[model samples]
Target chain A: MRPVFLIVLALISQASLADSPPLERQQALLELLHQDCGSCHGMTLQGGLGPALLPSALEGKSALMLTATILQGRPGTAMPPWSSLLTQQEAEWLVTQLKQPAPPQDANRH
Target chain B: MRNQNLNNFRYFLVCLMATVFLVSLPRAPLADVRGTGDLGLVVERTSGSLTAINSTTRRAVGKITGLGDLSHASLVYSPDERYAFVFGRDGALTKVDVLENKIVKRVEQAHNSVGGAISQDGRLIATSNYDPGGVRVFSADTLEKVADIKAEYGDGQLAKVVGLVDAPGQKFVFSLFEAGEIWTADLHDPKNPKIQKFKAGKEPYDALISPEGRYYIAGLFGEDGLALLDLWNSDAGIRKIVPEYAKNDPKLPVFKMPHLEGRALVGDYWFLPAVGHHEMLVIDRREWKVVRRIPLDGQPVFVIPRPDERQIWVNFALPDNDKLQVIDTRDLSVVQRLTPGKAVLHMEFTPKGQEVWVSARDDDQVLVYDTETFREMARIPAEKPSGIFFTARAHRLGL
Candidate 1:
């Protein structure tokens, strides 16, 4: 029983290590950001009441440069600092995802 | 040279740390491009502006604003079809010229105004508010607050008082709201009016009085049935819940909750939806019981009865597959299902009964449908337009 327990624990740790977001999961996250965040911001990430979060929105800012803006946040503006809610790693991942161009329109677009 | 080398090494360390930080930080901010253009126009309840739809077709028509602090506004067109009275959401009242599309006058906030009502004679424009537990009477012509009659009720009770129907003779105004109670106030003297309260339901929202003014039926949102009220009986228990129809139907989306805000008196029967039961509660006025529960497609919100009382117009409010479910009350069967909008809220029939005006809140526009054919007639752009009433009789009543 002790030997089996040790094996199960090892397997669990390995599984968790491989739990990085897949393409579909990343797309879903992007969709939520677009839907929920786009309400206040322009759909294309053009400036509205909120500062744009897209590549065109940020004018091709580097990942590190964007991280500084998100971590410190714009004071006296609606853009709240995300450092509290997001980890450094998660912010880095988000910045990497935003760097990609939006997909072309499809026939089944909702 | 050794000290200079040491300084260069320190600078190299700093650069490495910065590079690590850049590589580790998230490269993207969330891209929320989805929810921006869902609803065309949003009526800012806190702000007093009627937002126009961002479309060329809508912009070509026009935009009107400057009605003050209008909260949860219910609208009604004048009898002569010249003007519209907006029962502003915040209890302020405003009148608008329908053709010119401009606000004529603005009235200040009254009690907790939820529903807007015009008297039969159109001489009195009365609206009910929930918080202060009173109704404000306004002169339709002058847009003046003529009177405020606070009804007597138990202390520490918060009654919403949503539904108001002025009796045919215009002698009394009957209304029901949050606490499931019915009220009758004498309107002969608008100022210092006499008010009476009756235990109507466990929770009531919208009500319809019989044309003859002998009986009143209210949709109880809390109790999930219709509450019958006897107008003439002073000591008689006027409140009776329809037993057979009160239970929620498991089949429909509006199943078994209790009540929603739609009721209409058609022919000798009152057709309404149970809040939880996706079925329409058909009350046989003659029998005073829920004789039948007509099952429907989704959570029914508004019921538009034809002037001829032959057809019943019902709209489901679900965001997905939201459509206008038309029930021919004559047979209690769904004759047609038309997708009016994404989500429908309230509707009113033109006095001529030729056209039906439905407020598609999800789409931020009012859809007009021909009564006879149920075909799309025209669309009126509105801001979160929900409540509707008519003005033809209103002009005659001087309201």
Candidate 2:
């Protein structure tokens, strides 16, 4: 039931992307990755219950390795696969963003 | 007449000694606010300060500052509930007078530290360190170093210590995050202590003891399941409960590591957050078997069963962070889905379980609710408040 709903949502999201502005889609995806993926990957992507997702932390790991880990999470670990919710292209795009520097953290946040 | 005069003299002497003791101790203007230390401390993560709130009045009494990087900070209160020991992420341990709202003493004990626990006797404070990968004990009264025990496991390598807490008989129980082991230090003799060790699950992230101090359960992050230790009988060793429960279940991404600080002691059952799943696993404390699973909106970060065990109030990790759920203990179903605001980090019920206060981190406010109706009673502004610790914690065995 859940998988079927996710598939329908994916189809609608894709169809809407063609009609919706590209910048809006990009913003939504960024928010999805930042807030959704950031839940496990750490808010700053530094690390939490899961491993660190920082650029320096991912230094040696190739882009292919990260993309695979995102789409089809590593078995025997807490990392869950994002393939059902994220498209292949979206996963690849997320890897590129993660490879870049972390956003500026405000002084007030811990 | 002569005997009566002697008795009166004796009574006068006792009063004189009581006055001397009171004068010797540091005085605070608002120490006796509620007659009992039932006030709560809100850890303002971003601000590196704690806002003291009068639980009954629903107002901020005062704020104490100067602690550094409280990102993962944890606090424990003195037995009398007069002071709070703030354990900072930067490895600093500070003693603050809750009544006075000031840092009485602060010391940089390690390069980095997760948190600490105060000994059962309230005479010793032991810290779990990340840098030195060991536990350090300090004098609670003066903040002076007393003992240092290195958490070395295989090949003489020191491991980062996590889940440090004080148990009965003046013992500090903790787990090694890297070494996959648990150790109990007998601070009965603080200077020269005895230690008992047990092998726990892989990467036991954090652990909590039962309200009665019977079971020490550690949530394994690196692997599925948890490590259960029978503190009553250490010789039985550690047992794995719900062994590989995650293996058979569908892949669920654990949003954040569930904090095991609060006990899920609802009746005879123990409720715990399901790793990477939107559910709460209920276990029969007698056999430690799953009796039921309560489906929730998202991953539960804290499964805090109220003081009376009538209901369990839960908070989630982000993107479901803004929601709060109230589960009826009798039916084991959610009774309320509270939309408090963004990033509901932690919750604390009043000592009698009458009112629950929750910290909405991103909202920068702590919402107070009546437990019976689940109504928002008050909203107090805060700065990235994460943990809501009340003075009633002093009486609990393992906070």
Q: Specify the highest-DockQ model's number.
A: 2
By lDDT, the best candidate is 2
Q: Please, what are the lDDT tens digits per residue for candidate 1 over residues B300-319?
A: 65666776777887876443
lDDT, candidate 2, B176-276, per-residue tens: 98899999998877899899999897888788988778788887766767898888999999999876445334546554667885478876788888777
Q: For residues A1-110, what per-residue lDDT tens digits would candidate 1 score against the true structure? A: 89877765664344334443554545544543443233324333432224556657665577798767656655423344556445665555556555544421112122
Q: Provide the fnat value for model 1, as a fraction from 0 to 1.
A: 0.00
User: For candidate 2 chain B, which ten residues in a row score worst on lDDT?
Assistant: B244-253
TM-score (chain A only) of candidate 2: 0.69
Winner by TM-score: 2
Output the TM-score of candidate 1: 0.60
Q: What is residue B268's positional error in candidate 1, in angstroms?
A: 2.3
Q: Score the docking of each candidate (DockQ).
A: 0.01, 0.20
For candidate 1, the lDDT comes to 0.57
